[model samples]
Target chain A: EAEVAQSPRYKITEKSQAVAFWCDPISGHATLYWYRQILGQGPELLVQFQDESVVDDSQLPKDRFSAERLKGVDSTLKIQPAELGDSAMYLCASRPTGGLGYTFGSGTRLTVV
Target chain B: GQQVMQIPQYQHVQEGEDFTTYCNSSTTLSNIQWYKQRPGGHPVFLIQLVKSGEVKKQKRLTFQFGEAKKNSSLHITATQTTDVGTYFCAGPISGNQFYFGTGTSLTVIP
Candidate 1:
């Protein structure tokens, strides 16, 4: 089975620093999502992309967070001047057009000090 | 904004017992999906319920969607240690946006 790939399984950085995470969705998937999950809580959507265009980003904190899927295949999420509260598991998921379910990557665990 | 809530934020059950979790959405849903996440692991898709009053079973696990299409439930029979994890229900609010429930964490004790 094809799997979504994520890099840097774990990361720890100081507050006010910049951090970035990458995700490569399965081939042929047109829908990609980036989610942030606090401890003991459900995942929260931060951004969604259709092909190379952003479809929804209302929940994203544009002041400090940014995400891009330039070619519609892989994506990158960045948080500049990270805050302590930003520590969480960042998950990336992808689904085919009109597909019923999503395949999630292992996720990048972020820890801000 | 849409929200999905799950009851019994946490559940502890003895091995071999049955367990169930309920998910309720603020608005009618086009479809509902169930996912399981083990400790330190990412969410894994388990099933999807579409039609109203639809029910599906996968081995010892059963899933049901309400007639109103606003709620759903997941039941596990003869729970085992491997069943320990958090269960989440998700529904799409629009063509591109999906929301996940608060999640129900389960701990099966042997």
Candidate 2:
């Protein structure tokens, strides 16, 4: 089965350092999402992209976090000056046209020391 | 902002027993989706309910959407070791943005 590909399965960074995670969604899936999952907590939406255009990013911490899907396919999420509280799993998901279910990536686990 | 809540933050069930998780939304949802995440794993989509009062089944698992579309439930009959994980309910608040419930973590003991 096709799956979303994510890079840097695990990452450790010092506080105030910059880190980035990459995600390649399944081909032909137009909707992409970036979510943050803290330990013992549900996933929280960070950004949403529809065909290379951002549909929603209200929850994203714009001062420190940024996400982009330039080609409407693969995407990247970046955090500058990472903080300890930023340590968590970053997940990417894609939805096919007219599909109800989402296919999520394995996720990148980030640990800010 | 929309809030989704799930009951029984944690559940420990003996193998072969039944387990249920309930989900509720502060506002009516257009649709509700269920996902399972094993420890140290990403969330995997399980099912989605769109219509009010809809019911769907997948093998031993059953899902129900309330009449008001503001609540849902997931029931696992005869739970097994493989059924251990956290179950989360998610719904779109507006457009493509989705909000997830707090989640219910299940542990099946053999």
Candidate 3:
């Protein structure tokens, strides 16, 4: 089975530092998503991409977070001047067009000190 | 914004005991999906229920979609230690944007 790939399984950064996470969706998947999971809460959508265009980012904190998928294949999410409250598990998921379910990556756990 | 809520935030049962989790959506859903996440792991898709009043089972696990298409339930028969995990239910808000439930954490005592 093909799996979504994510990098930096864990990250620790200073409050004012910048951090970035990478994700590679499974081949042929056209829908990719970035979600944030707090300690005991479910994953919340941060952004959704269809091919190379963003479909929805209503919940994303535009002031400090930005994501891009230049080639419509791999994506990167960057947070500038990370804050302590930004610590959480960042999960990347992808699925083929009109697919019923998603394949999630292991996720990047971020911690800001 | 959409909300999906699960009941019994935490559950503790013996190895041989049964367990169940309920998921409710704020709005009518076209489809519902179930997922499980082990401690320190990402959520893994378990099953998807599409039609209204549908029931599907996976050996020891049973899933049911309500007739209203706004509620779902997952039942485990004779849960084992390996069943210890957090279960989440998700539904699409629009197109491919899915909203996940609060989740239910299960702890099976060996």
Candidate 4:
């Protein structure tokens, strides 16, 4: 089974430090999503990308968070001056064209101290 | 912003016992999806319901979408240890933007 790939299974950073997470969706998937999941909570949508264009980022904290899918393939999400409240699991999911289900990556766990 | 809520945030069941989780959305949904995430793992899609009052069944799990498209439920029959996980219901409001329910964590003791 093809799976979405995510880097840095776990990350620990000091407050105000910069951190980044990377995700590579399954080949041929055009729709990609980034979600933030707090402990004992559901995954919250942070950003959505249709190909290389951002479709929705209403929930993303634009002040310090930025994401890019330069080639419309792999994506990178960066946070500058991370805060303690930013500690959570960052999940990446992708859906192939005409597919009904989303394939999710293992996720990047961030622990901001 | 959309809100999806799930009932019984935690469920404890013994092996061979049944369990069910309910999901409700503040806004009508075009479709609802269910996913399960084991402890320390990523979510794995289980099923998707698109039609109103639709029902789908897997080997040991049953899923239903409410007649109003604002609620859904997942039922497990005779759960095993492997069924221990957090189940989340995600509803798509627009395009690919989905709002997930609070989730229900199930712990099955064998």
DockQ of each: 0.91, 0.92, 0.91, 0.92
Report lDDT per candidate: 0.95, 0.94, 0.96, 0.94
Which CAPRI level is candidate 4? high
With a 3 Å backbone cut-off (N, CA, C), the pairs that clash in candidate 2 are none
lDDT (10s digit) by residue, model 1, range A25-46: 9999999999999999999999
Collision pairs in model 4: none
What TM-score does chain B of candidate 3 reach? 0.97
Error of 4 at B27 (Å): 1.4
Q: Output the better candidate (2/3) by lDDT.
A: 3
What are the models' TM-scores?
0.98, 0.98, 0.98, 0.98
Task: lDDT for model 2, please.
Answer: 0.94
* Residue lDDT tens for model 2, A8-105: 99999999999999999999999999999999999999999999999899899999999999989899999998999999999999998789888999
Residue B44 CA error for candidate 4 (Å)?
0.4
Q: For model 4, how does the per-residue alpha-carbon lDDT over B17-98 read when each residue is reduced to its tens digit?
A: 9999999998889999999999999899999999999999999999999999999999999999999999999988766677
Error of 4 at A17 (Å): 0.9
- Model 1: what TM-score? 0.98
RMSD, model 1, all Cα superposed? 1.0
lDDT of 2 by residue, B13-79 (tens): 9999999999999889999999999998999999999999999999999999999999999999999
**Cα lDDT for residue B7, model 1?**
91
In Å, residue B53's CA in model 1 sits off its true spot by 0.5
TM-score of 3: 0.98
Greater lDDT among 1 and 3 belongs to 3
- The worst-scoring run of ten residues by lDDT in candidate 2 chain A lies at A95-104
